[model samples]
Target: MSETETIYDQIEIEDFTFDPDTQLFTYPCPCGDRFQISIYDLQDGENIAVCPSCSLMCEIIFDEIDLQEYLDQIS
Candidate 1:
């Protein structure tokens, strides 16, 4: 079985880069790679941003309603 990932930080959702085209959210990882999550992942209630280059993750702080509103404004 896969091990559960641990969150390194609880950062505000505003700290991530939200791409309008791909609808993906990304944040800088200390390892120089970016941690990424998708808009659909947010809609599905996923809040963890995982770094592809390392075993690091972060919790994204965002309200469901507020997140939807923000997505609406951007889209």
Candidate 2:
């Protein structure tokens, strides 16, 4: 038997849309749904964007400091 690991593609944070009102970052997934991650999740050191319609996820690369700035402005 062989085991396969799910590998998620790494994406630039700029590729995702940051909603100021909802504070959620979203990107279009190949599954026709959006990959989403919240600013609170990012603040907690999470960078994974998961598609609600599928078992696909990606890492969002971003600077923690820059994220904080956005959070601050919204707050």
Which candidate has the highest lDDT of all?
1
Q: Model 1 — TM-score against the truth?
A: 0.84
- Scanning candidate 1 in windows of ten residues, the lowest lDDT window is 66-75
Report the number of clashing residue pairs per model: 0, 0
Clashes of 1: 0
Per-residue accuracy of model 1 over 1-75 as CA lDDT, tens digit each: 146757889988888888877888899999999999988888898888889999999889998875775588566
RMSD of 2: 3.3
Candidate 2, residues 1-75, lDDT tens digits: the string is: 113535368888888898989899999888899999999999899888888899888889898886966677687
Score every model by TM-score: 0.84, 0.84
